[model samples]
Each structure stands twice: as C-alpha cells, then as structure tokens.
Target: MPAGQWSSAQGASTSTSDLSGRYGNGRPRGQALIVILAVLAGVSGVAWLIWVTGFHGRPLAQSGLTAYEIVDDHRATATLTVTRRNSGVVANCLLRAYAEDHTTVGELNFTLDGSDPKRVDLTKSVRTEREATSVELVGCTADGQPRPR
Candidate 1:
C-alpha cells in the first residue's frame, strides 16, 4: 500500500521484479507455442507422404493412343505409345475403345515385361462386337498384385 516499501507478501514480491526478469524477454510463451506447432506440422506432413507413396505405390508407366485405324466393324488396330520407367518391374495398361457417343465397345489388357526403360511404340489389335470410333488408354500401373509366397 506504499510507493517505496518492503513486504513479504506474495503479490508484493512479483511487482518488485522487472517484467522482463519475471518472464524472460516477453517471448517465452509465444516462442514455445510456435516451436510445438512447427514440429507437429512437420511430423504430420511426413506421415501423409508415407501413407500415399508407400501404401498406394508410385506410378511407373503412362500410355497414350497415337492413332487408330478402323479395319472393320468387328476389329481395329491402334498404335500405342507407352513411357515406362523403373526398369525390371512389370507394368500393365488398360486400353478401351469407345464409340462416338463415348460408350466403351471393347477393352484390352496389355502387359509390359519391364526388361528395360521403355519408350515403346507398338501396334495392338482391338476387337469390338460393334463398330468403334476411337481408341484410348485408360490407366497403367506397375503394381503386379504380386502373389503372397
């Protein structure tokens, strides 16, 4: 209760010390909170990356239909370009033939033995029950769904 006085009271002792002395540099709380949040964010990002690339497996190939020739109503041939990497791992691609209305008329399952790095251009014959207009590559994967030993 006095301007210049000494007391053993609890609140009096806290007031006597300077604010910086009491809570070092006025940044202890904020600095600690920032550090904790940064660590958590880093850990969460690494976990998500592992889950995506490890469990889901990385893509090893991509395919495109370069050209198609309509041989007849029941059969056609298409030129396919496949770019594959990760040598020695088998890759598979799914190709589909579609009509003008985007209806799938036929499908082909193509496999690459993965002997070497691939920039392969090959012709494949596709068969449809009815006439089809265009050929397209649907998807490609390297995961062979290996059988458990």
Candidate 2:
C-alpha cells in the first residue's frame, strides 16, 4: 500500500528476509547464471575467431590464370601463376578448359617441383575433345597436403 514497497499475493509487505528466503545470500537469482553464460559465450567466440583466422584462413597454395588461348579444335593452352607458402615443397595443379556452352572440354594435371620458385608462371597445353572457349585453374595443393576446396 506504500510507494517503493512490494506486496505479496496475500497482501503481506515483502521484506529483505523474504528476498533472502527466495534467493540465497540475500542477492537476486539468475544474476550469477547470466554472468557465467556471458563469459562462456565470449570465450567460445574468441576461440572460434582464433581457429578461423590462424588455422583455416589462407590456403597452402594458390593459383591464378594469367592467360588462356583456344589454339584450335582439340587443343587449348593455359598460363598459370602459382604461389606456394613453402617453395621447397612440390605442388600439383589442375587446369580445365570449358567450351562456349560452359561444358568442361579438357583438363590438365601439372606438377611444380621443389626446384621451382615460390611464385612462377607456367604455360601448359591441354588436349580437348572439341574447341574450348576458355581455361581456368581448378585448384592447387601441396604435396602431402589437402586439396583446395
């Protein structure tokens, strides 16, 4: 019946004793649980960020298509620039040629030996069933390493 005073269902004025009876240590309930959950979420988020940026961010090897030429029917050529984190390790790359209809017409598998530099441009030719309109590097992976996705 008075301002700043809480009442119970039975019309009894609630006091600190009532609060202490409902919540242990005379503190509000759920506060500790909320803080604990917040800390756990923050820790989990930081762990995920570290895993993503430190472990899974960059690829072991990368390849880019520098140039491509449709030599003629049944033949195509591609120039690729390959870069690897470890130049002393061997790497493999796959290049594909596509027709005007977007169908894969040819594919070539090439190797980068340890003697090669960390970054190098390679020119290779592919034998296709028909004429190819364009060529691209499908992927590259270091020896004993997982293939790029």
Candidate 3:
C-alpha cells in the first residue's frame, strides 16, 4: 500500500488512517463528510459506551425489581440493588430510559437508599424506537448514598 492508500477487500482505498485527528480532509468533500460523520459517530459511540460502561451488562438485583416494558408510554424500566460490602449503603433506585442517539427521552433517575427501602421505579421509558435505549442512574457518594440530582 502507498502512503495515501488503505488496504481493502476490493483494492486500495483512501488512507483514512492517514488522518491525524478524528476526521480527515484528503477525500472529496462528500466522501470526507461521510467519513467524518461515520468516524465521529463511531468515536462518540465508543466514548458513550465507555462513559456508560459502569452499568452495561449489569444485572438487576432480585431485591427490588425486574426489567419491564409498558406500551402505554413505549418505555421500559427496571431496578437493580447495589450493595457494597465495604460501605453498606442502600438506596431506592430508579433509572430513566434513553434512546439510541444518546437522547434522554423517558423516565427519571432511580433513588437508592438503605435507610429508606430496596425498591426501584423505572418509568417514562422509550422502546427501541428511534434511539438506542439507555439508563441514567444517580451517582452516590463514598457513603453509598445517592447524591441529589
């Protein structure tokens, strides 16, 4: 491959790897736009993934609630109990629903407090309609108590 070419299944293609930043300008405007958009979208996607990795694939604790869907609001909500043996703080958790484009369109944050109870209420969820569904839970301090939103 040349300095400005990339190896491809078809043949040599534009050297996207040549771009110094998240985007490049070597390709035509349209191609560049597409590449730029795709790359930004991908980078944002991975970044968002990393940003939300704290709760990805995390299972909902049987203590509170299960993942449920409601057609009335086209949303789904669930609660997972988080108990840190080291800290021993409990909270009533509620996680709102989000879309694929990273847009928050439904529900409010769940509340978690050991002093209160171990139940979570998920609401205003959006089905996998337009954006990718996601949840934004409230963060807690070192004491294991959820901080005010």
Candidate 4:
C-alpha cells in the first residue's frame, strides 16, 4: 500500500517493484539484461510468427503429384493433388516427362477448380524423341502460369 514498498500474500517484503533493489541500486545490470532479453525474445517470437503466417493469410495455392506411371514412350498418367488455401483462386500445374537422360521430353498444363481437396487423375501425352523414364509435377501457380522447372 506504500509507494516503492509492498508485501506479498506469503508475507514477503520488497522495497521496490524490482527485486534488484536489494542490491542497493534502482535495478541491477543483470536485471536489465534479463528484461532486455525477455523483451527481445517476445518481440522476435511475434515477428517470426507473423513472417511464417504472412503468406498463409493471403490467397495462395500449392499442389503435388501423388502418383505417376509411364504408359508408354509417349504418354504417362499422374495423379495431381492441389490445395487451394485461399478462396476463389484457381490453380494450374505443369506436368513434365523426362527421358532416361533426365531431359524434358514432354509436358502438359492442367487446371483445377480451386476447391477443397482438389485432385484429378490426368493423362499427359508428350511426343518424345526417346523413351520417357519418369514424370514429375513441376509446380503450381494461382495465376495459371504453367512453367515447369
């Protein structure tokens, strides 16, 4: 009840709000350091959370290739799984086929309706000079840019 002095429910006594007052100064250097570190940690944690969820709060899209099978030298089948984290955003992916030498032999661009758990089984046919050994879903974009990397 007194300025710069109080007692806790456990009958503990203090001359100031700061425990460092026992050391005969306003507050000890270590107390200041601890306060600084605590503030810094709290601020950094908030900033990190903001940075991580910044894109998540916006209209974004992601997609993955769940399964693929080579039907022939010129055709392949794949399962595309697209996730539209934001509403009203349509996404598209570029499916690519590679030859035995890891060269891009064929590619196809496909679109999605941007619905929840969006998935489709698609057949990608590419006329390659050689046999395709593998297929991959390069990437998906909300803007319908089907650039397969």
Candidate 5:
C-alpha cells in the first residue's frame, strides 16, 4: 500500500531485492541468452561483410568499347580493350553491333588466349545482317565462370 512499493498478485508487497533474488546474480532472466545471441549475430555479420567485400567484389575480367567503325552496310569493325585479373586464365567476351533503331544486327563471340597479355586491345570484324551504327562490349568471363550480369 506504500507509494513507492509494488504488490504481487497475492496482495503481498515485493521489493527490488526480492525481484533480484528471484532472478540469478541480480540480473534479469534471459539477459545472458540475449547477450549471447547478439554477440553471435555480430560475429556472423562481420564474416558476411568480409566474404562480400574480399571475394565477390571485383570481377574476374572487364571489357570496354574503345572504338567502332561502320565499314559498310554488312560489315563493321569494333575495337575492345579487355583486362583480366588472372592472366593465366582464358577469357571469353561478347561483342554486339546495333542498328540505328538499337536492334542487334551482329554479334561476335571471341576468346582471349591465356598466353596473351593481361591487358590487350583487340580489333574484330563483325559481319552483320544490315548496317550497324554502334558497337558494344557485352561482357567478359574467365575460367568458364558465369557471364557477369
């Protein structure tokens, strides 16, 4: 019945010491479990961050469209500059030529031998179904890896 006191369901007065003794070591129940779970979550989050940043951050190979020329109505030339992380692994690249309407008029699948330099500029002649206005390097992959999205 005191202003600063609490009563149990049985109308019995309870004090802070009574609650502390009811729990272990004067700490709330499940506090240790919550702390353990939080520590585990923190550890796993760090591990995931490391895996993402260290392993999957950089691509194996990269390509850039250097120059393109419309040789004729059915022919075009594309120059691609490619770079790879591992020079000992072979890399495959895709080049596409598009018409004025942005439709693919030709496509070329090329391979860079492992013996070649890590960074190389390649000129390829593409035979197209019609006149192509622009060319693009689609992507590149190494060691039979999946093409980059």
Candidate 6:
C-alpha cells in the first residue's frame, strides 16, 4: 500500500480506542502465575485437612478392646481383673501393669488353664508402691494370638 493510502485508513481506527486502558506498572507473568498457584495450593490444603479429620477424632475400629476393671494408684501394685473366658489351654497369662504415663512398671507372667479363674500378681515384680499407677492385663497365646478382648 502507498503511504498516503495507509495514513487515511488509520484515521478510522483512531476513534475505536479502548476506554478502560490506563498506564500501569504491570506485574510480570511469572509473578501472576506464582500468585495463582499459591491460591490454589492454600485451597487444596484446607480441603485435605477437612477430609482427613472427620466428625470423630479417633480412627474407625472394627472392635474396641473391652476394658474391664481399671485399677489405678493401688498400694505397692496395681491390678486389673477381667472375667477369664474358657478358651483352649492358656499357655501364658500375663498381667502387665504400667505407670500413669504408660511406662511399664511391672509384669507378672504366669501359666494358667483357661478353664479356671486365676489371679496374676504384680506385687512380686513391683518393688516400689509409688511407681504403680495405671494397670492393664493382657492375655495372649504363646504363639502370638491375642487373647479374646
């Protein structure tokens, strides 16, 4: 095109200016992309926190252990007794007692037939009465099968 013909055509486009345009110190494309990614990351983090922590705090257990008698702060020894159920030959019956902070203070190991009511004594293993705080009895097979909870 000739220069004079191009000058005449440009006059018509001069009136079609963008109204909302202003001089701006624009943010770089990298910075804008980083801000967009940060926003998305924050939203996803909140969603994951909500999904992991449900209505209840504890995990879903198939069967909770039946807590029998909770003996705490007993003199010289703490003891927890549960009704002994008749299983096969109970090779090992252990009454493991702990302190208030779940520290193993004493353990009384004994062999008892599941058919009869037996008492496991922690007094023999417990040297100090002050250390005995919380007690729990766990019976298990010698082969590692956890006794019926």
Highest lDDT model number? 5
lDDT digits (tens) for residues 67-92 of candidate 1? 88878897778887777655676767
Which run of 10 residues does model 1 get worst, by summed lDDT?
140-149
Clashing residue pairs in candidate 1 are none
Q: TM-scores for all candidates?
A: 0.62, 0.76, 0.30, 0.55, 0.76, 0.33
Provide the lDDT at 57 for model 1: 61
Q: Order of all candidates by lDDT, from best down to worst?
A: 5, 2, 1, 4, 3, 6
Clashing pairs in 4: none
* Model 2 clashing residue pairs (backbone): none
Residue 62 Cα positional deviation in candidate 4, in Å, after optimal superposition: 2.5
Task: Give per-residue lDDT, candidate 2, residue 53.
Answer: 86
Greater-lDDT candidate between 1 and 3: 1
Candidate 3 weakest ten by summed lDDT: 140-149
Off by over 4 Å in 3: 1-70, 86-94, 116-149
What is each predicted model's overall lDDT from 0 to 1? 0.75, 0.84, 0.48, 0.69, 0.84, 0.48
Identify the superior model by TM-score, candidate 3 or candidate 5.
Answer: 5
* Candidate 4 Cα outliers beyond 4 Å, as residue runs: 1-38, 50-59, 113-121, 143-149
Candidate 5: C-alpha RMSD to true structure equals: 5.1
Query: Per-prediction RMSD in angstroms?
Result: 7.5, 5.1, 19.0, 10.8, 5.1, 12.3
Q: Write the per-residue lDDT of candidate 4 for residues 34-147, one digit (tens) a residue.
A: 999999999999999998678455435666677888877667777766666565667766878898888898888776664545444444554555578888888777764333
Candidate 5 lands at a TM-score of: 0.76
Where model 6 places Cα greater than 4 Å from the true spot, the runs are 1-24, 55-58, 62-96, 99-103, 106-133, 136-149
Q: What is the lDDT of residue 66 in candidate 4?
A: 75
Instruction: For candidate 1, report its TM-score.
Output: 0.62
